[model samples]
Target: MDFAFLFIDWLGKPLWMWLAFISIVIALLVFDLGILHRDNREIEVRESLALSSMYIGLGLAFGVWVWWQLGPESGMNYLTGFVVEKTLALDNVFVIALIFSFFAVPRKYQHRVLFWGILGVIVLRAIMIGLGTTLVSQFSWVLYIFAAFLVITGIKMLWIGDKEPEIGNNPLINFMRRRFNVTDEHHGQDFFVKKPHPATGKLVWFMTPLFMALVMVEIADVIFAVDSVPAIFAITTDPFIVYTSNIFAILGLRALYFALAAMIHRFKYLKPALAIVLIFIGSKIFIADLLGLEKFPAALSLGVTFAIIASGVIWSLIKTRGSQEAHSNGG
Candidate 1:
């Protein structure tokens, strides 16, 4: 049974329970903004690690509980979707790090902007999940289309290797720049510049570089969702599964961004692995109908994907280091 069927098959609490869950999520966000993260500063490693662990533990705990309540199968589906989304999101981290460096974002202010930026992404992806769920339920063929998109995306990623993203000429960024009196310098993690500085009272003051960075971040997220949403669809067509898993994964992203930022360059081969993972998922979705294999269990897929990513990352790190050492020592 696939996601929609699984939704019916799995017994869940009433609508009120779901409402309560959403309410709690909102409360968490409020607390994060109002209390936990009131002061804007560079996130410390220990704090980042704690939040990352907490978010991950919460997701896994929820998944396990779901497994106990629903069955191992659905639990696995949730985990699979979460893992895929999480791994794919790692690529985003690399780009974000580059963006920060490119714009010369101060370490202290980085988390402040990213925290809000990720919140926006959550809202956007939520809408996409709802839309995808509706579309997939009504038309079984939509799965094949999503599969095809992923395959094509994978091809593009592999064919175009080791180049910086071309965000400089993005139409939206250009247009926004032309219309607004954007500040050339960054403004302490402020996404938008309200107007002239209160002290200066000058008309030249406008949007800041941080705002531009936020737009770039959102643009990347949109492009990424195209590939990621389909990957999740392959795992399960239930919109709830896709949305919940994605949100849980994303909730940890800010912390992960900080924890993994320094090591991102070390995992140089991550993009190719992501491309391969996308192709794997896409092919699975595309061939399911042809093979009369309606069910591709999540645990198997998750295990295989994790192994592939780990191997690729480890190999790349070792090779990169070996090359540098060889050059230095004349081996």
Candidate 2:
């Protein structure tokens, strides 16, 4: 149809490209909710792995499509951003797991909270990326600030090491408790339920722990975005590439969560690898300046980043193998 080809430019990208991306995403979500996860049940590691593989495959496939349509440079940038965002989101998986445990969210209902949470993330990420794109367009010098921020954040992560979050004393949890009516227990998958007010004896909606957990997870993603958004901006300021890569990475997160949470201990080395990745990405811009290069080669950047992550994963597996065996034996 002529309608499909009548492309008006949106943010330097054609309407058709945007429409294609949106179409794929919509199809994936429909498949995810309507078909694959038609019934909410406890997702075992095997099922999680299967779903994760599908999402990861689709994300990479989109990169291939980018390569074909937009040429190698943009394609490489998309892949780089995708890899960076996916790895950065690993840290978030830890916090989400903690929130779920603290709220005592049953496995069956966990998907429901996470599914609705995706809707929030789609809107939230769009706003952040749109703002970031605007800032970069208006003030080109902002890239330097992003680079500096990434370097500092990476160094801070190295210094602080990994520590489990203390959810019991989280200020947000405390604030929510003080400000609203919170049920003492989860009400199935419901985020809210109508119950009689203690003082007024009038029916009022009370938030369940599941809802609070969802809120906390959303907040956690926002916090992580502070690090991730800058890292992606440092990679390439293309709004289309940035947004697509970020959303694709996030689309798989819930599926990845089940598999990763169960074996989080095996990823002990991933944090340092991520820190190094951030530092490398941040430093590339400055390094290009000294070398009189327009920009670092996208292919080289992607290769180095992937190599670092692979090394970290392999080393973590080898180092943690004994501990895993010991735990199994003891059990």
Candidate 3:
């Protein structure tokens, strides 16, 4: 077979780079599902932390590779995008927990839903990032819109603070229930199960609560992506850096969910920090324009983003130490 196509450019990067990233993601998923978790079981917090750490290590290592292969600027952009995406997804954890709780999904089966949900996310993010690239390439001014949207969203987040999503009142859930043949209870790890129709007394396919939970999780990611995609694009319009950093960050965050979901309430200050980060990220473009610079310094952006998130995490840990103990004792 001719290997010339591999060097052909696609979305501002050589096709081989995209293929390599895809191959790595597939291998990681196979290892995670086939080797590590062939049997359905609850992921303990310690195990979750370890798995998440491995993913994070791999993500950062990929950044190092980008640094060696690309340049320091690209590396900084990747790191900043990764940090911003990962932290932005912290809010997603709370929503996932709420989805699982609302659907009454068993702890052991939660990983199944999330694993499948990741496949959906991969496709969804690709579509979104692709569209974003197209728009930005064609209409240079669209970045301003994205930047403005981020600023408004950041302000809204700051004003609203942490409000638990009203999962039960969601229209999508209601619509699914009204439109689909759904079972009132979970059927093990199955999203859909063949069963006799209740009214017609004929064999039919029925969606379990597990499936609904998975759908909700997918939707939640899409919703959150609206914020994160633009945020990353603002950092670097290079599709390769944007997509790779996004996937890596999400892969790690999904692994981290089991640990974070259990203690999501402890991160009380994180929302505010994330809001500030958004405001900072969004304002960078305008700030650079005001300073008559082509773009903001990637190093400064990375440093500021890291410091803000680290401060939030540290502050949350300190403030919630007593709450953690109380929760343990109460449980």
Candidate topping TM-score: 3
Compose the digit string of candidate 2's lDDT tens values, residues 48-68: 999999999999999999999
Off by over 4 Å in 2: 1-5
Q: Clashing residue pairs in candidate 2, if any?
A: none
List model 1 lDDT by residue over 1-331, tens digit each: 3444323322134454355457756776777778888887778778888988988898888788768866787788888888888887888888888777766788878877787788899889988877887788889889889988888898899999778876666688789877867777776667666566545787455887787777778878888898899899988876656777888888788888997886666677878888888888888865666778777657778887788788878887886786656655884
Query: TM-score per candidate, in order?
Result: 0.86, 0.97, 0.98
Q: Poorest 10 consecutive residues of model 2 by lDDT?
A: 1-10
* Per-candidate clash tally: 1, 0, 0
The candidate, 2 or 3, that scores higher on TM-score is 3
Clashes in predicted model 2:
0
Query: Roughly what TM-score does model 2 have, to 2 decimal places?
Result: 0.97
Q: Can you write out model 3's per-residue Cα lDDT over 1-331, one digit (the tens) per residue? A: 8999999999888999999999999999999999988999999999999999999999999999998989999999999999999998888898899999999999999999999999999999999999999999999999999999999999999999877789999999999999999998888998899999989999999999999999999999999999999999999999999999999999876679999998997999999999999999999999999999999999999999999999999999899999999999998
